[model samples]
Target: MPATGRENHTAPKAVYIHIPFCTNKCFYCDFNSYVLKDQPVMDYLRALDREMELTVRETPPGEIKTIFVGGGTPTVLNPQEMEFFLNSVKKNFPNWAEDIEFTMEANPGTTDRDKLAVMKAGGVNRVSFGVQAFQNELLSGIGRIHNTDDVYRSLENARNAGLDNLSIDLMFGLPNQTVEMLDYSVSKALELGLTHYSIYSLKVEENTLFHTLFQKNQLPLPSEEDELKMYQLLMDRMQAAGYKQYEISNFAKPGFESRHNMTYWRNEDYYGLGAGAHGYVNRRRHMNIKGVNPYVEAAMQKLPRLEQFSVPEAEAMEDFVMVGLRMLDGIRSADFAAQFGVSLEETFGRELHKMLSSGLLEEHEDRGGYRLTGKGVVFGNEVFAEFIGVLT
Candidate 1:
């Protein structure tokens, strides 16, 4: 109850539940998800329940401050199924914080009045709608079945259900995406009175449709210069709309920053439930089996399809630096020392000094630490790689 640390440390305050069923897979999405035409929805839920039970029995989490049910479109579940899934969550993790920030990811097409009500009743305080873009043409191009109307209707449903903590996701740098189109998407998302927004540039990941198109010389993504302009335009627009850029790709109204995601950025541990879910706790990281059938079978046998590895001290120290730097506030030196029982300089002195000299990172005067500069953010992978060498 006090928390988990040496003297006054606190236990992990976050939870992530993966719902892997979706109506259909998007062309650009490679997340662990499957199409749900005639899939055994109830059976999967039962397996998820078992998985949750087994997880809690192994390592019971403390009072949770945040719970994020992300997915393959969590709203794909029917009202009854949604209720069952959420209730199972409560039953499995009974001791949640009083002001728990419970968020659920909903696809615009699948969310309806009934589903919204069920989610609200199930303790989902925030709903993040995947609204990719405003234009119907772009939506279809991205293999999204929902039209603009579905976005409007879904927001209305959530508002009518008294769920006002809403966030909308948008994308830029898509094939054939223009600055004008990006503006329209941002304007439409603002018109919905969303409290948060997550806008990301498209990355052609391997095995995705976009990758295939790129290999075939058919991908029509924006030029690098245009993509840079789009990023600047979004930052300017969101700032004008009074949204705070809390993390790289996330903006929020005052007090609405994503608490669950902050857990990861802050390098804190949390439990990840369901297939393909990953977790970090007690200096160890693990991942659940990715395939649905394999996950279900493993859980039924009281064996999580999990692979655990102990994070070495040096790696953990560098991890603190890498993940904590993702936040705008940057890392705190004293906190890092307290957590690791070693000074920051003693661990990453050479890499930190080198990066600081290169203008890739700057020292945080208030926190006695370092954070990525604007230049570094553009080339963060390079900056992070330095820490890996330090670990070696």
Candidate 2:
């Protein structure tokens, strides 16, 4: 058995493909992506195809359950390029589950009806749009190109093209954003009645424009008190709308959780393809080269790995608790023991006891494992931080 408790020979069921081109970079995004103009799109696609071919030959996949195509903006491809890319995916990883949940990320103004039709025809059943906010002023402040109208039009196009399993991403704690503004965004989002919503708070990541503004004290971010109020209101409103908070930042109707994302939260294995993608399989992890042309050149001859290494068992166990606890279901004792050949109590006894004593964690009522108390959810970072360096 693998360190992850799955059979070492069992093929990975999830795959992540990256498309590095977007129309423009958002102010707060630190993802490995580039603007579309002058990029060698076709050459990059062919390189990706080669990578997939090499990948499957080395680690032949089983019935693929999920494939997530993320990008600077995957939907930026024209129909022809989109068709070619999707066909390459089908050709290389042909054995898909009957109920596979293939998802592609898109920018609102980029996905037209024609492009969406091609996406649906090529086995993409889900589309997650980057509609960061409902307010145009906030959107502009964040360097997003789409207006509120583009969001509606894009959704209409997606539905019209037979892609109904839709999700939109919203952000709070943006510059000059008020609690009232967040409320308005959530209300407008709920009015769409989509199956999933991913609401995130702004983080001033290094290398992003927001981070520079923050350092210069030019970023007009909301106060910490107001941010807390916004989160409280968000949780209350999402629950009131009957959406389940399956993960910290994700809400879904029952049975509509993002299965692709679940693979990550559950600490399972997946293939990561394309420039700057990361993959973990058989207790080993690898990150692809980040630059597009450099990646293309590298993939032409061999696997374009920037770095790959085996994860130490102790570090892996720490990761298991940190990511698994992000989900509302939390980590179970049985699952933990299965992966590491040790009970959770035996491994994380002191940390668990400390959190439980602090009223931050409680044994799940219906489930056997421990979960966060309401207070813990708001302070989840603190709980997760407790586990770090405990094992190592």
Candidate 3:
């Protein structure tokens, strides 16, 4: 069970809705998604609606501050299905905040003008296009269905449909990629004049094509030194273009940062609906089952097929430090104290002292909180690992 005596507090401020259907899974992808052929799309949407209904029944919907519809590819759904899903969301959670940040993930090839207009009508104000690269060769190398033309057309379609707040995702260190390729990707993305960007370095996880290539020493990724240089170049270019690096991998025009992701980094409570979605509520963490059919069946019975566990206070403190440090502004000591009812130093003074001594972290003189220095951000995982269980 989750941490007891914490359930009577206010409801969550954010909600993450996962759509698990995709036209085709990319080669280097590991997210919970299924191919569209013969999949029960409508059934899954109904199940998702049921899950939302049950969640609101358990905890009345608070002022929803952010809602992100991510997934296999939200744009894969037909217009009617999209309408059904979005309607379910509005019907179940009617008390959305005035400035709610509603974002939906789209694929370049899947979205059309009509579909985007429907999305805009459904209260979606932001669209994130999955444009892994600007070159067709790189797109094919990564098994993405869309080419450069598709990306340009999609962005234009989004603008034509009146959805202006757009973001594009780019990847670095891809197979057969070079520094020049990365530069081209970023340059082309900027040319689109997007409001936000998420640039991620490829990680070779198990069951991914990249993982197989890595095991065989067949990957054509750039050298580590080159990769680091690429990262620096991206940061410099984005900053020069006036985009703020709110988090390590995300950049946005000032005041256009992603609110849904901020809810996660802030460790605030949120409802995660759909297969393989994770939720943090009432100081407890739960993960829904990853399979689509099982999730649907379980949700149909108004039961979350989830594994629930309470996050220990010590672990929570460590998590707070770890996640909060990911932001450029770093953790707020006052917020930590308020959440834990204990001074920040009282909880992790020794760990902070050790990290400070090692030059991996520095305390802000004016802010009076710890933040990662320039060198610290590169070794952030190392520093966070040290604080994980140091107090316990």
Question: lDDT winner among the candidates?
Answer: 2
- lDDT string for model 2 (1-392, tens) is 32545444488999999999999999999999999999999999999999999999999999999999998899999999999999999999999999999999999999889999999999999999999899999999999999999999999999999999999999999999999999999999999999999999999999999999999999999999999999999999999999999888999999999999999998989999999999999888999999999999999999999999988889989999999999988889888887877788988999999999998888985778988888888999999999999979
Q: How would the candidate models be sorted by lDDT, starting from the highest?
A: 2, 3, 1
Q: Which ten residues in a row have the lowest lDDT in candidate 2?
A: 1-10
Cα RMSD for candidates in order: 2.5, 1.3, 2.4
TM-score-superior candidate, 2 or 3: 2
Candidate 1 C-alpha lDDT tens digits along 1-392: 32223345345678898989898888899899999888778888889999888877777778989999998988999999999999999998888888999999989999889888988888999999899999999999988999999988889889999999999999999999998889888888887768899998888888788888899999889889988889888988998999988777889999999999999987888888888998877777889998887888788778465697877777777788888887767788888877877778877888889999999899989878888887776667788788874665
Every candidate's lDDT: 0.86, 0.95, 0.87
Residue 170, candidate 2: alpha-carbon lDDT: 97
Candidate 1 clashes: the total is 2
TM-score of each: 0.95, 0.98, 0.96
The clash tally of candidate 3 reads: 0
Model 3 TM-score (2 dp): 0.96
Q: What digit string (tens of lDDT, one per residue) describes model 3 on residues 107-170?
A: 9999998899889999999999999888899888888999999998999999999989999999
Q: Which prediction has the highest TM-score against the true structure? A: 2
lDDT of 1: 0.86
